[model samples]
Target: MRRKVRNYILIVISMVTGTVSFAQTEIENPFGLVYRDAITENLPGKVNIQPVTYTLNGIEIAANVYTPANYDPDKKFPAIVVAHPNGGVKEQVAGLYAQLLAEQGYISITADAAYQGASGGTPRNVDIPHNRIEDIHGMADFIIQYEGVDSERIGLLGICGGGGYSLKAAQSDKRFRAVATLSMFNSGVVRRNGFRNSQVNTIQERLKKASDARAQEAAGGEVIYAADNAIPTEEAELAKIPYDLYREGYIYYGNTHKHPNSTFRYTMSSLLYLMTFDASTNMNLINQPLLMMAGSKADTYYMTDEAYRKVTNAKDKELFLIESATHIQTYYVPEYVSQAMEKLNVFFGKYINSEA
Candidate 1:
């Protein structure tokens, strides 16, 4: 019984870690994508997916650029740079939204963060807040220069942890004319205070662990990691998790939408930076149009709400709540996804497209 209780705790920790990394698994889709209805082969006159690689701060970044049906390179089109969720890759919900946005006639790009997924970096899954924010900026840099993309009309979409980083990226990167987030997750806040502040009492203990991990790395010791356990596969075990974000997250990332590059683990030292960062800080710097979306029923909604409330200088800032949808449901549920896409279309169309 004690062992079972410990296992349950570990599973919960794994679910809440957010950032992830692991050995690559063989993906069944031809494009190495795991999302539903992923583009198998690029064709003419339909939404086409292009595999792209570019260097960001000397690290090779892997990304996917989606073009609208009957895309014309000669004619400039508004584009969106999509930032994937924590422990997520370009091929999951990020790809789904990129594809769906493309279907709506917008060019979109989603990239794996540096040190995670197929992107190049050392000390794999070093998920510091600054690096994550830079990843969002890097995606913006690449997509803005892509053929047929209007440099002046680039928008941003970030999911989950990516949403928090995107908020930071848009604070200074004027290239993102419009900014939007779905299921925004403040990784820094969670890492420091714990999910809903559940682990607040352990802040000092966790920080000590992170400091020790960093010292070990400096001394060339085997890197310490956090939340490296595999997700529980049994229904009885999964039901033990309390939070909806985590409970459904296991089902989504572990079962239905499992991808080769997704796992919940990060260098323990990353907590040094993550624990000090806050997505809500200096949000007034985002002077561009902003649209923040989250499920009304999501346990993580507080993060989005708090961040949204801090955007004092944003032009036309709005908080959109998808009724009856939890945080994870907004990732893949057709009903919730459709609702998000509908609102995104109107938001991006209004701000990024001059013709609209």
Candidate 2:
């Protein structure tokens, strides 16, 4: 009985550490996207990647631009700017979707926000709402001027937290001819109310803590943050943990899809701004075509649903759901991703090319 108990504990530990059968691939690229269908290296004579850097508010934002096979600077093409999740960098799912869209002949770009990823900024991982919104606008500013891009036909695709920011960006930056979001997560909502409103009663307390964090930063003190949970390596303990969102997120962002610059934590001081912002507040301002997608089984599906309903002014709109897929699964799971890409292709094609 003692031996059996010990073996069971070990199994739980492995699960907690994300050392299970699915996450066993050897890390290949510094980007650390090890999923089965991940495109780690650029394919010769096909999709080409250009590492780019541009200044945004005196900070250099790092980005990757993917051009399709047989790209010609002489031929105009519709462009798309992809926004990464809140805790994510441009090199993960955002990059993946941008590359796949390029495969279908659209020029796509994904960039690290000013204070995150390979981008330059102080007070690292500060995830304020306005900054993320500006990041999307900045991507539009850059990609609109790229060679062969049709500025009037530029589109936007935001994933997870990026999705929320993209919506806010589209509210005023009408340069985006069409806007789309995948697995939309309302960062402001989750940050303010807590995931699933679990911390609704503690809102004032958390706000006070955020206020103190800001004061500390003002005094040049150490940064304070949330979401620094240590990775668990025990299967029993891991299995006991609930919330598939956090569990699978750890497996992806922290393990299989880990990148050197992809830490998900954000400054606790950001809550001062995050808790009061609402990405969907001015949904009526988005007067262009819009597409919002979420996994039907995602715990965060309510966000997409709520936001989509408020987009009453979109010239055309859709809220697509990937059946049987959870929030994190849609990030890299081949079938779910393919479904999203297919829908995006048709949506962008119809709207972006309507004038041409």
Clashing pairs in 2: 12-234, 12-235, 12-236, 13-233, 13-234, 13-235, 16-232
Off by over 4 Å in 1: 1-27
TM-score of each: 0.92, 0.91
Candidate 1 residue pairs that clash: none
Model 1 C-alpha lDDT per residue in residues 154-253, reported as the tens digit of each score:
9999999999999999988998999999999999999999999999999999999999999999999999998884887676676678898888898778
Question: 1-56, model 2: which lDDT tens digit per residue?
Answer: 01111111001114245444443435354334434444556666788778889999
Give all candidates' CA lDDT scores: 0.88, 0.84
Model 2 whole-model lDDT (C-alpha atoms)? 0.84
Candidate 2 lDDT score at position 66: 87
Per-candidate clashes come to 0, 7
TM-score of 2: 0.91
